[model samples]
Target: MRIIAIGDIHMAADAVTRIPEIGSADLVIINGDLTNFGGTDDAKRVLDTVMTANPSVLAQFGNLDKPEVNDYLEDLGINLHKQARLLRHRLCLIGIGGSNKTPFATPSEFSETELAAFIEHAYEQARASIDLTEPVEKIKIPTIFVSHTPPFGTAVDRLASGTHVGSSAVLSFIEERQPALCICGHIHEAAGTDHIGRTPICNPGMLSKGGWVEITVNDTTVQATLHDRI
Candidate 1:
């Protein structure tokens, strides 16, 4: 499976849609920030544009987006927020939308406990989806944790001002569970890659800046290639 993941769009559909990989990839994962303090209508505009190129879109709303946007995305059957869904080739996507509370007071911000709960909930959902008859080791599905907030203390969560503003909850979960991959965004300038143990993490930055991650998965092996702006 070839997946093109973009983040922090902030309504800049053209910047990301123009990328040639969008039309050809098996899936397009919109990390977050589909709107700028806007509602579902704004998200619709952005999602509609991306779908025009490729309709296989899985999205999560960011702190900048309204909470109600979740329902809208769910209605469309393309929402990945707080969800664990199976994709082709036994690939499972575990998603957590929104971000931890910030001083700026974003619309969809949640507390640390809430974020942690969301992560566990999504992971359990994925675990439940697989057949339990096989041994746990034998049925290890390739999983990707897509969180809007990057994990704390990683390069992807640091600010230009040198402050680490990532989610400690996310950090803890990643440390313990160690999913196949952690794809994140929210800190736009901190567009880079990092790792916790063997799990690779990628923050694709803002789509307005043309940052994206190309992931190719073959069985349990997942390779993520980060693409920065042109």
Candidate 2:
């Protein structure tokens, strides 16, 4: 599966247009922060641009997003998986939204404990809902987790204070349930890739500033490339 992943578009529709076509992949995952203010209109505009790309879109709402904004995206047929999904024959994708509590207390800010609880709930929901009769093992699939907040201690999560303010809860979750890949983008400056356990964790950074990650997944391996648009 070829999956192009980006995040923190912040309502920059042109960034979506700039995504290079991948003839090999089966889907696209927009990690979050699709709007500047989580306004319904902004979400709709972003949804329209994504749909035009003509690939399956897996998305979640960022802290800037309002409830109505997410609803609007759902109405437009964008798959909003706060939990998880199995895509094609080889990919299992999961999403978590918002970020650890920030000073601003934005619409998407959550405490570390709160974020952990949400992630746990999502994982339980996925386990309960997924059919086990399928040939591929759910746990063994090339699972990719999406979150608006980066995991702690990654290059893609360094704050202006030089603090790595990523979610420790997220890091714990990944440690407990190691997935094939993890993608995130909330700390714009920390826009890059690294590893957590066996999983390849990536923060495609802020698309509005022209950063994105390209991923190719097959039965044997997964490869990711990070790029910045000039």
Candidate 3:
């Protein structure tokens, strides 16, 4: 399967108009930040733009998106926040929205413990359909975890001041769960990839700034590429 990942557009809903230029894919995953404190109307506008690209889309709201916007996205059946869906029989996609606490106290910030609990809950939801008899390593299905914040200490979480401002809880979850891919954003300046064990993590950066990640997944391998476009 091919996936196009976009990040942190932050109110520039019009940017989706150019998504097709980046490439074609089976799915488009909007990692987060579709709006800047936007409401249902704004979310709808963004979704409309995404539809223009004519691909199946899944999205999670970023810290900058208002909580109510989730309602709109849910109504449209494109919200991936705190939910999981089968991309194929052997692949599942899970998502967690919002971000860990920051100094600025963004409206969607969560404490470390809170974030950890949320991750655990979401994981359980993701695996609910699987047979409990199967061992963790024995399960053939690959999982993709989508979050709005990168894990702590990764290249994608670095700030201009050289600080790694990501979620330690997310870090812990990735280390333990070891999903096939962890896609994130929110730290726009540090758009890149990092590894937690065998898993690959990506921050596609700010979509409004022409950044995106293209991914290709097959039975034996997964490829994620970061890009800078105009």
Pick out the ten consecutive residues of candidate 3 with the lowest summed lDDT: 129-138
Supply the TM-score for candidate 2: 0.89
Report the lDDT tens digits of candidate 3 across residue range 1-230.
Answer: 88888879887767766765534678889887788888777877887787678558888888888888777778889888878777677677878888988888676777889878877776777667565555333477788889898999989899999999999988998888788889999998998788999989988788888888888889846678877774
Q: In order, what lDDT does every prediction score? A: 0.88, 0.76, 0.81
Ranked candidates, highest lDDT first: 1, 3, 2
Candidate that scores best on lDDT: 1
Q: Give the C-alpha miss distance for residue 209 in model 1, angstroms.
A: 0.9
Q: What are the TM-scores, per candidate, against the unseen true structure? A: 0.95, 0.89, 0.93
Locate the minimum summed-lDDT window of 10 residues in model 2. Answer: 131-140
Residues 77-145, candidate 1: write the lDDT tens digits. Answer: 988888888886378898999999899999999999999888878877776776455422246577788
RMSD of 1: 1.6
Instruction: Tell me model 3's lDDT, rounded to 2 decimals.
Output: 0.81
Once fitted onto the true fold, the runs of candidate 3 whose alpha carbons sit more than 4 angstroms away are 20-24, 135-137
Which one wins by lDDT: 2 or 3? 3
lDDT for position 177 in model 3: 78
